[model samples]
Target: MIATPVSSPAYLEYGLDTLFGRITKRAECRIGLEQVENDAFCFAIRVPSPLSDDLEQAKTLVLRVEGRRLQGTVRHSERLEDDSLRLEVEPD
Candidate 1:
């Protein structure tokens, strides 16, 4: 789906910590126009960091917007919560 900005420059980006001790910087990962129903949205973010041979494995992370923030997990590897629909993505 990969939602994109329409009227303005508003979108969501996710940063991941990879298994190579490298931090994945923030980048726009819009699921699609149809996916974003309101100011609030939930998306499955994959933290590339692993439990083995990786930096910290990125067990817990944060999701922030305009000041409001929430905590996310990589316990099962990038599984988005049920509050919002999951966006279709290419196979990793």
Candidate 2:
């Protein structure tokens, strides 16, 4: 499902990218959140850039969903046909 991320004055809630305890935000990007099998979370980053371990794709991510924060690890990420990045995350 397509979703607009919840807007917040805090960059961490919107533009901030948390990785290795560091927060970074460059160009703004949107992602669709979905639930996968085994309580995993599918976070889709719709960008043309390829997914890499440098962008924290290989590490755990904290996702804010339904007013709660969930910890997840990106199991795999692939460049979609539409140039988007699909990350299969398993909640931990």
Candidate 3:
């Protein structure tokens, strides 16, 4: 598959099941280009610091962009000097 950069606004959502129903944390983010190397693929996105802890803990999240939903796992994350969190995701 050819990976392309997503220019639309993306949202990340992770949910938890509770007695009250499934509560979800959602944050707006920017979806980077999907990269492929040596037959392996990787995806990435950037979210604000406010959601960093949640995303890191959740590990897996649904990325919604341009009407498409991609389920991915966080492979790695790093905090930028500007405080945004850059996450490396492997789409499943």
Whole-model lDDT values for every prediction: 0.34, 0.46, 0.65
How would you encode candidate 3's per-residue C-alpha lDDT over 1-92 as one tens digit per residue? 34445444787787545568756788786655455445367766656545545565556678877777887776777777877666677788
**Number of the candidate with higher lDDT, 2 or 3:** 3
Whole-model alpha-carbon lDDT for candidate 2: 0.46
Better of 2 and 3 by TM-score: 3
TM-score of 1: 0.27
Alpha-carbon runs more than 4 Å astray in model 3? 1-7, 15-24, 29-40, 49-53
RMSD (CA, Å), each prediction: 11.0, 6.5, 4.2
The candidates, ranked best first by TM-score, are 3, 2, 1
Worst 10 residues of 1 by lDDT: 47-56
TM-score winner among the candidates? 3
Clashes of each: 7, 0, 0
The candidate that achieves the highest lDDT relative to the unseen native structure: 3
